[model samples]
Target: MKNLKIDREKVLLGVAGPVLALVVAFLLTALVLIVSGYNPFEPFELMFGAIGEQDVQVLIINQTGVYYLAALAVAIGFRMNLFNIGVDGQYRLAAMLSAVVGAHFSPPGFLHIVLIVVTAMLVGSFWAGIAGVLKVTRGVNEVVSTIMLNYIATSLIAWLTLKDQFGYQAEGSNDLTTGEISKSGWFPGIHVSDLAGDIYGFIFVAAGVGVVYWYVLTRTRFGFDLRASGASESAAAASGVDSKRMVLTAMLASGAVAGLAGMPVLLGQTHTYSQSFPTGVGFTGITIALLGRNSPVGIAFAALLMAFIEKSASQLSYATPPYPPEIADIMKGLIVLSVVISYELVRRYGLKRQQSRVGRELAAQAAKNRKEVSA
Candidate 1:
């Protein structure tokens, strides 16, 4: 269990900023609703009533797992101060190729799952490695490269799916899917009842990933060098840390984790990558990573909160007379905006505070020495 007591700096930076931003975002959303002529409280009331239902709870848990993986993937890059926007492309490509590989193979049950996972990680790492290589060798910016990769991945998947060899066939097939994966490949689900969807057993996989992320980033020497490079490339180089290798490794790690972002949907539920497969989760991971301040525990809570908001707000449209569903989108946007702004302001304040404290300490020390000389 975490210690109940938090230091002032942690409270200010981690807790205060997020809480203030959330409060402001909600206030702004309420204003938006009022100006647009709707009863804001009604939607919240309706959403709160539905949020506790068995099915809704299951959805929140399922989505939280996916989002958590995505956030962890993004956080890996973030710790190195690298922006990896290609998670969308990485996961989608990984899921597709992994699915294809899984369909063709007939290994032992556990080994089959292992092979599929390894395929995904390899594909994701290779794809992300392109950006890493470009950055190291050609001085290209990762943000630009990753964005371009996302577009490339989209088009590439389209072409591959249309080819007969990868399992594209009639347009009216059960789904825009490959041949069904055998039961051996499927990750068993935790059964509940008909009313609530079974929790994906792959949730344990997500939990394991989170633990590894925290351990590796906090405990390992490579983690120290990676963070040192992020802080100052010049300082790291002076200390014999290879900034280029760190960049490449961080990107590869980011992409490898990104590969797992879609596995729950594939191995746990869908069993294939198709046109209807979940998309845009990679992008959502970026948002969650920022909201969670790139901390593992924070990301977990943020993921669940985001999933909960989406799950609950969706019910507004089904209300007796109906409330606008777009309200949820507005709330999300406002919260992100507010949080970004708040963090910047708090960071500046913290810097100024440190400067003031240092100045006062030096001045006091000098005066004390002068007094001693007079004595």
Candidate 2:
């Protein structure tokens, strides 16, 4: 009973931390808005009202798609203790490469779209392989190297959009975008209504990805080695784990996932790569990774929650003041902060309780032994 109570408390604490963080952050943001002469209530009403049937359909497809792919990408390296901060670069480069390939070989109908996506995955994986090689051979820290690589990729893509044969500029204009992908290259949105088409296919993809990620991370031998390497390099090495090889492989895998993330924005949403291809997706991965605690399943839920808040905020913007709608990012940050702090606190608390329990058990055993001997 006592053990069960302790376990229950731990579980409750885990759940409560994020919830409390969200509530407190919103209230605080609301207070700030009130002082700014805006009625928080009005905006709140508008935001919810904006979630009309049509908007709900779009919101689910766009925001949810981004969240799942981005979070999973981040979690891959997180599992291996390699901070692959180059998700932005990986995603951008892959997306552009995919677009370029699709343009090069105009296939028939859906085949064209499929080729572009596959090309994106290959390119993204290869790009990430650069960081892996550097880390394994030159001992370059992936965090630093990947950050620099992001800048290089951004510049390279920027250049590609302006150059001949690779120019993705608008006709007679210097707009930084590639030619629109073929109509057949686009992933058709699932039909929710005659007036509204929802991109339900992406949601289905996300669900599949979540399952695959969970299986790979928890059920596979490769997953065990990755976890072991993340937990301790020396211990893992001693156990015959090739830490370096794992790092490189994990990084490539992470980049591939990030590349897939761009598909939503590319094939599903925009059907082309633009100068604005890379948003804060890579950075957002950090938030999702932390919120999800690097668990594939947890990441899915956390990503959904974030997507929900973000979508809701956008929806509310139609009726409410900007305050309520703008509060999504703030809420996300607070939730992440709370989760981090709470995780650390709970971990320490658990360790102390474990020590106490062990000590008590040992003492009880000693007492019993002494009595038996005396008797």
Candidate 3:
């Protein structure tokens, strides 16, 4: 009963912390908006108004799917204490190479799409693997290695996108790209209505990735190893878990997922890799993962919240009073900060209370045994 009660309390904290974090976040954001001479309530009113629109709803859902993939990408690396800041690099490199590969091949429909996705994953894994190798083999910190890799990935992409490289200048245009992927390589978008855009075909793909992530992390020995290594590498090694191997596996999985961060555009909308293709999504994923506390369900909620904020902020341009989109950035930052602060406080308080409860229980048990023995 005592253990059950403790478990119940844990569940309560899990729910309450996020709720409180958002509360604090909004409060802080309101303060900022007031100080900056913006009517904070007006922005939210506009946001809620836009949320009622079908086109905006579809846009939010589609973007949430993309953000989920990105957050999952970062969360995987984070699980093992590996900061994969290089996710930006990993996904872009994968998308570019996969676009090139898809352009070069003309396979059947299903196979062509599958090959493109697989190519992205392989490239992302290899790119992230370099950071893992440096960490394990040369004692380099994963954070430093990944950060350095990001710049290298950017440079490589710049070089590869040049005309006469993997890409070529488009007809009558100055833009260089891998060119349009054939229809066979396109992931078929789920059409909603004429008023709204099609839902990203990769939405299901992201969902599958989340399911696999949760299942593998909770149910498999590899997951056990990964979690143990994350908890403590020395302890994990002492228990016969291969720390180095876990690092490599974790980094590879992280990068592979990061690879998908670009796919919603590559296979769903753009069908080509170019300089204008979305970037910085990897960084945004990191913030989302942190806000979500790195759980599958939490990540989903966080991604949706993020998408709503982004789309709603963008909508503010046409709102009655016209609030700036920069306010959205402020809100996002505050939420992340509030979550971190609130969770940390919760952790310390919970730990102390647990220790006190354990002490009391032990003392009570000792008294009971002493009285019985004396009698």
- Models ranked on TM-score: 3, 1, 2
The weakest ten consecutive residues by lDDT in model 3 span 314-323
TM-score of 3: 0.96
Off by over 4 Å in 2: 1-17, 31-52, 163-165, 170-174, 194-196, 319-325
User: What is the C-alpha lDDT profile of model 2 across 1-375, one tens digit per residue?
Assistant: 988988897777666655555566667667766787877566556555656668565765577777788788888998898888898888888888888776668888778877987888888788788999999999999899989989998888878877675766666875666677877887776766665556646566767887888888899999999999999999999999999999999988988888888887777667667776657787777787777778766677777777767767765556422455456776667777766776777677777987998899999999999999999
Error of 3 at 271 (Å): 0.5
How does model 1 score by TM-score?
0.94
lDDT of 2 at 365: 100
Candidate 2 structure, TM-score to reference: 0.88
Q: Residue 293, candidate 2: how far off, in angstroms?
A: 1.3
> Which ranges of candidate 1 are over 4 A from the true structure?
1-6, 168-174
lDDT of 1 by residue, 1-375 (tens): 233432566576677677777888888988998898888678878878887688988888899999999989999999899999999999999999999888889698688889998999999999999999999999999999999999999988877777565765556665456656777889898987798978988889999999998888889998889889988999999999999999999999999999999899899898888888889889889888988998899899888877877888879988777888888788878888988998888788877877997899899999999999999
Model 2: pairs clashing at backbone N, Cα or C within 3 Å: 43-320, 43-321, 46-319, 46-320, 47-316, 168-177, 168-178
Which tens-of-lDDT digit does each residue in 251-338 have in candidate 3?
Answer: 9999999998889989998899999988888888998888887899999999999999988787788876777788889988898888
Model 3 scores what on Cα lDDT? 0.90
